[model samples]
Target: MTRMTRLTKWLLLMAAITLEVSATLSLRAALNHPALYVVVAIGYIGAFTALSFVLRAGMGVGVAYGIWSACGVALIAVLASFVFGDALTARMVMGIALVIVGVLCIELGSQAAHTRQTREGEATP
Candidate 1:
């Protein structure tokens, strides 16, 4: 199978994150409306499906999962603040920033390691 482009991988990750966040939010809303449980079910299922595609696209599982969880947490917190009047303090923002930075470091480190492995493989007889 053809490898997915970098943009496609990232886009799939983003879709996964969005679906997860929406599902979580729907869960919260379902407490009141109850009918939104349908959305919660659909969203969670779709999110996992998208994540599977991301993995099949050749992105490392650690990087894909880290970014997916980080973005999902951040988006849920921020969106919930607006949608449900949940508190979003400065400390929470800082924590989200740290999570994002940590994921970025993992991705960069993974890329560097892959490059080194490729070079070493090429150098071997």
Candidate 2:
């Protein structure tokens, strides 16, 4: 990819991740009222829009979503425990770690597929 495309992808990825974080935070806040589907819908739509931009910039959907969700979950759990005084147990921590591992595996798998495709295309005569 061109440098500009790479930069744009990175920017879109950041935007996607930021929207996810915002959505999670808002949903957490809206839970008490439970009449905030509009707010939740807005958040979800923003997140999906940003994600589409990122995917359009060449990110694989599974890889992008896996990484985005892993990071979001970790951050949400941490903030939930600290900001909302939600329980933070060893089981939860382990679950978060497993999610991180899964994300990494998705990234690796995407990279492998991308590299294989690149090689195959190059070999076409």
Best by TM-score: 1
Per-candidate Cα lDDT values, in order, are: 0.92, 0.82
| Candidate 2 Cα misplacement greater than 4 A, ranges | 31-42
Maximum-lDDT candidate = 1
TM-score per candidate, chains pooled: 0.91, 0.82
What TM-score does structure 1 among the candidates reach? 0.91
- Write candidate 2's Cα lDDT for 20-101 as tens digits: 7777777877888676656777877887898898898888777788787888888789788988899999999999999888
Q: On residues 71-112, what C-alpha lDDT tens digit does candidate 1 reach at each position? A: 889889999999999999999999989988998899899989
RMSD of each: 1.8, 2.4
